[model samples]
Target chain A: MTVSLNDLVFVAMALVIVVAATGVVMLKNIVHSALSLILAFVGVAGIYFQLSAGFIGLVQIMVYAGAISVLIIFAIMLVMDKSVEKTNLFSPNIIRLLAGMGLTFLLFVTLGVSIWFTKFPVVPAEGPVDAVGMLANLFMGDYVIAFETAAILLLVAVIGAIILAKGAEDKQ
Target chain B: MEHLFINIADAFTGWLMNLGLSPWWADLALLVVQWICIVTIVTANITVLIWLERKVSGFFQERLGPNRLGPFGCFQTIADAIKLLTKEDIIPSAADKLVFRTAPIFFIIVSVMLYVVLPMGDGMQIVDLDVGLFFFISVGSLSTICLLMAGWGSNNKWSLIGAMRAVAQMISYEVPLALSLIGVVMIAGSLRLSNIVAAQGNIWFIVLQPIAFITYFIAATAELNRGPFDMPEAEQELTGGAYTEYTGMRWALFFLAEYTNLVAVSALMATVFLGGWQGPWLPSWLWIIVKTYVIMMVFFWLKWTFPRIRMDQLMSFSWKFLIPVSLANIFLTGAGIHFFKWMGW
Candidate 1:
């Protein structure tokens, strides 16, 4: 089969995601790694856009690339000492390396098995889809319990963090 | 008058197709042309905006402003731009080279990308995505990272402090900004900006969702890092904030990007609240420009009138005041929609 423009775009975005994900893992500088993470997030968003999941794509950019990456970088800056270099060290001891390799192999096998066993749905070629509407309905209707549970979980986390912070201030 | 730009674009694409190019190539060429046109318009508009700001600030302070350069100092911004171009580019020796250099470029790119979803006239937008409003908000959020880059890369205490302040302020205000727009989205029943504009054909959302409009205005000002909320680049406190180490054209890019954002946000405000591009006498495109400028004038007025707020005060204002108000507005909007439906109006 001849490579269509869509295939080319998919390949390009896939390459970006792979390269940026690798950079996030391998980059020596924490800030650079964070930036690479942002790139990877953006590439995932592009893939979502390609799949016509516009709402999910925008949310990915907003929550991941925009908010989460900034938060990561801010945490990095706040916690790291002035010595920017040598912040992210890769120590490859035998035990650590073996553990890491085992975890990686396990993850790979799990993902591979899941992909091999899963039956993918074939989407019909149709006019534009109302992704946002479908998502809203799913969240508010059938998955309302799960959605509310996640919201409540986040609220608890926020309150817990606030109380912890305020408790520290009181001690000071 | 309504279909002027659309017709021209169609003719241009047709011309490209007649040149033996495939449909895909022609469309790509059309996209490139649109991008070029957007950049040119943004730059030209910024030139005028800068001059207007100077003049308006002069009016505020009872001064003549830049009258010496050209007629009412219209050419002053142009001259200043040229000077900035000619000035020696300086990078701090200790700076992070890549991030420092890329920050302004990224900032400007993010700012210009905002224009894509803006319905400039009736049936006028670049792509008109289903999640147009969401696209705008999400893309606009990326600019925060650019400021952080500028600050981090500068390798200066002032720059780092400024960037930290900017990130904190932007993150906080972003909540209120997004929440305030939810009311309009609820009323219009769509996040598509063009649909929101269309819904306001009868009555402006400003009247219907006044609380949303006010909260949005406040949140947007904080987002834009303008006066009273400009904690990021408080010159007296942070010495130009994230931009302290930038010089020459590098500094100019940040300036241009800020104005670009100002214009984009003002246009969005016009679209969401003031019935975008809708007027009785004027053409749709001209009407949008008029409404955008009117909103921009209010921005300018607020900037010139208020003193810069303290960082803590700015943060508290967003978290304590604007966020709660916007959440209340959303509740009111939901209740109002149900009430109207129950009344059979």
Candidate 2:
């Protein structure tokens, strides 16, 4: 029944995640929303760090908070009109709102039930796990095919993007 | 000499424990003390570095640097710091108030966060995370957001353009930077900064992975936004770029953060390639400082010697040249590792 420092930190990080996520959804300024998304990403990374998944946490920060957030902001800057006071608009239709609320409620219920039913594994107290090494082994040994497939998929996407960009230049 | 700082830290922690503080509270106190020491060292070091940079640049240009304030103008930066602190803090009327206010604060915080993973000496890191190098890189990447925030929040064309250029340049160079380090990581078989340094006990990675060293240097230069690759904040073109809307202590914070990043990257370079903290005559900490300063001198030399490159040229240099070169270095490193293993050496 005693609240420890770890629990306090977890609560703080969870609050950050929830508040930032809310900001992402409710903010009228698209840029502010994007910034909120970054905060939420960082909070999630903090949770990963708290769970001792340092590799995953660092990857989360690097890929999500760092690169992806920048990309999102860049896109926002490219498309946004300077004259607009509020960029992000919500629909006023009651039917759409009702539908959205229903869907969100359903999702929450499903996720809550799954979490309640799931049995979590207890981590051993021996020492810190070599998460990075185990991940490397998983990728290279057991999941090599899946890993290589993801790599090839990324390469193909890059090539397709380049081709699309090059075609637009040719037309210009 | 090697354990001097460690012993002092232990003694301080013991004293706190003797005062009836719990182990956790005592450890937290020690961490706070380390944080204060790092901040003080960074500030003091930056004071000297700024003065040295001015003197070196003046030497390069065959002109006398500031020599009026103190002996050889050694106190010039302190004077400037006071002036900056005393100057009026101006926030643009049209600016995004929250983002503008938080940008420099976040930038400096991100810059200082990089020190956590830096192996200052033998067993001298703060936390010594297993993925130390990755932690440095990921935390370093967060600075791009600070710049973006500065640019977007300023609501100025020049600031926006400069920030865009900076983000593009940083993103492009980051790939090569990470790739170039893979050679060292492959050789060391670990991403921990201390472990990488330990692997270099016999020979420096610079001697082994020459291509990686070269590519890493080039990429790091671009990443740090130094001269020849400083597309962001191209003063003549963008007029201070992301810093255009900032004034007084706010602008000073950005300047301090940039110099802080310069030192951190230089120190990392020393650790990765130049055999960190390894020398005969001096203590490990002193050795790291010497190597970091030597690398920083090269940075200063390059900055003063070369004209700023065109933005297009900078992008192409990183994407077309450095990336390929770094990728080839990774290949070569893998081949060499396998070759060494096959030879049963």
Candidate 3:
């Protein structure tokens, strides 16, 4: 199989994402986890680029890697110990872990069965890259309300964050 | 996606068909040339920018900038570069050495990457990606990590405080900085920087999105840590902020990155709002230079005009005022676009 350069880039980006996500989970240091989160975000942006979602890729990098990562780092700084300790789950019972695993397995089996049984026809309309144009059209035409809602949601988040941070500062 | 990649690959293959060499080798050659162009432009701009900044700063303070070493201090940055090269690189006694060393290099790379899609003249861009506007913003934000690294690696209280403030301030203003562009993007109906510029062939989006343009300008100023928004490195308060302990070349990297960021952001503003590379009877490249320098002058004026806002005040202003204004601008832009279409004017 002749793999094109884009395919190579896509595979490389996916590998990066997986590795960075693993690092986030496995890294002992909280700061390291935060930094790894940034790496994961960058990987996601790369994937977005491969998908030809240039605007979204940029947003992912700017908001997640740039703004949110910095916010997390600041949060890390505010915390007393920068070291990583073992996280304790409330339930130490083996039965609980077993039940959780059982539920996850059941979900996977059910999803797989449904997908296999369903004979859904692939309605070919446009390629995935055209999703950008489609999304913009929907945003202005049919999904304008939802788009406005997203803007409102971001505004609310900003307000909430400001209040929370300010309330903490006032107490201090 | 496969089809797109195949097309690009096939194009390369066709180009190398005459040479009787494998297309893969031609692809590699193309990549090398692209990278070389990117690197040469980035490095040359950084060097030129450093000199321009020193001269600008000196002129602002009513002093001779750097006329000693070379003509008009043309080689001043070169001399400074040599000094930095020879200076003993010092790590803070309690600093994390690995991140410390990695941070400056990452900072430089991020700043350099900003030039990738930036068009110096008509059809003269390195990579005219469709999402050029967003790419610039995204890559531009990566420097914040380097700043954090500088702050954390210094192991000084001042450095920590500076880094913390910088991270907070930059993140806070990003909301407005980004949201403000929605109005322009709406007016242009595309996210591509080139398309946005082309849309302004007759009347610039700035006329329609004046509020957004101003909001973006102010927010981006804070984002770039210039002047009134420069609380992160307020020497009077934080003792050089995040870079309290950086010396020699590492410090130079941070300095160069900041100025380069200023240039990039200013250039981006020109591209998005101020009729990028567009004017009457002037060459496109000359228009770019004019617009870019004009924006840079505004930055200098901003730095010299307003006093730094309190950190808390900066945060609240962005969250409370700028974000809402930008969102409103976005909505207004949507309505305005529809109305303009209806009028068919």
Candidate 4:
């Protein structure tokens, strides 16, 4: 079959995502790693766009790439050790490198076995999805109980954070 | 009356079709031409706005701003453009060259992408997506990356500090900005910007949801990094902020992006709250322009009059005060809508 524009775009987006994900893991500088992670996030969002899910694509960029990436960058900046400058990114120690490689290889094998061996059936797309409205309905109407539970969970997390940050005030 | 731009676009596209090009090719050509026009308009507006901002600031300080260049100093930006174009582009030795070179371009791209959903006039938007409002807000949030990139790439303490503060301030303020819009969204019952404007055919949402308008305006000001919330580029403290290491056209791109974002935010406010392009006598396009300019002037007024707030104050103001107020405004809007429906009015 001849490749269509959609097929071309999908392939391009998938390739970009793979490369960006590789950059995220391989980059030595934490800041550069975070930037590469964002690129991967955007690429995933592009894949969503290719699926015609514009709302989800936008939200993916908004939450994952925009807000969370900024948070990651902030953490990197705050925790960075500026005094340490190394020419080689990887450690020269043999045992540590082997251990890391072994762990990664294990992960790859597990994922490969799980995904490649599964008998998944493909579902062809019927028509365009009203992502925003469908999502809003799912959260607000159909699964509102789950939605409110998630909100409460977030509130609990916020309180926990406040307590952690203000621990000194409690003692004083 | 029909949209002026639509008519012109139709004429141009029709002429292209007469050249015997394929349908998709002609459409692609139209898209390219429209993009060129949009970029030109954005650049032109940024130039005029930079001059206006200077003049407004000058007037605030009781001085003549750039009077020597041309009538009302209109040509001053043109003069500045030439100088900037010719100026040396410097990259610090310690900088990450790739990110440093790419940051400003990314920043400008994010700002320009914001204009895609903007309804410049009645039936004169680029693309009226179903999730237009969401698209605008999401794309607007991505500008933080540009700041983070510029700051990290520069390898300068001040730039890093500025970027850190800028991102923190922007992200915190973004919650309230988007929340405040929910009140308007609830009232409009649609996420489309054009529909929101149309919902205000009878009256503007500013009058109905005054608290949301106030909350949105304050949050938006902080989001745009102007006035009391202008902590990111507090030149006294952080020098030039994220673009500190940048010079010439690179810095110019960042500068242009700021004004472009300003125009975008005003256009959004106009569409959401001020009954965009909806008036009696003048054309709809002129009405939208007038409303946007007024909102922009209000932004300038706030910028000039207010003192720069402390970082703690900015953060607290967003979380402690604005967030709760916007949430309450949403509840109030929801209840009011429900009450109206109950009464069958």
The regions of model 1 sitting more than 4 angstroms off are A113-124, A168-172
Tens-place lDDT per residue, model 2, B254-301, is 999999999999999999999998989899999999999999999999
Better of 2 and 3 by DockQ: 2
Name the better of 1 and 4 by DockQ: 1
Docking class of 3: medium
Predicted candidate 2 versus true structure: per-residue lDDT over A1-172, tens digit per residue: 9998879999999999999999988988888888899999999999998888899999999989888646655666666666534776677899998999899999999999999999999876743567778898999999999999999999999989888878645554
> Which has the greatest DockQ?
2
Chain B TM-score in each of the candidates: 0.99, 0.99, 0.87, 0.98
Question: How far in Å is the alpha carbon of A55 misplaced in model 2?
Answer: 0.5
Number of colliding residue pairs in each model? 0, 0, 0, 0
The C-alpha local distance difference test score for the whole of candidate 4 amounts to 0.88
Q: Candidate 4 chain B, which ten residues in sequence have the lowest lDDT sum? A: B1-10
Model 1 over residues B1-345: C-alpha lDDT tens digits? 778998999999999999999998998898899999999999999999999999999999999989999789899999999999999999998998999999999999999999999999987788888899999999999999899889989989999888888889888889999999999999998998889999999999999999999999998999999998888999998889999999999999999999999999999999999999888987899999999999999999999999998888888888899989999999998999999999999
Is 1 or 4 the stronger prediction by lDDT? Answer: 1
Off by over 4 Å in 4: A83-96, A99-103, A106-129, A165-172
lDDT-sorted candidate list, best first: 1, 2, 4, 3
Q: Provide per-model DockQ scores.
A: 0.73, 0.76, 0.53, 0.72
lDDT digits (tens) for residues B116-157 of candidate 4: 888888888888887899999999999988988898889898
Best by lDDT: 1
Cα-based lDDT at residue B109, candidate 2:
97
Q: Lowest summed lDDT over 10 consecutive residues: which window, candidate 1 chain B?
A: B122-131
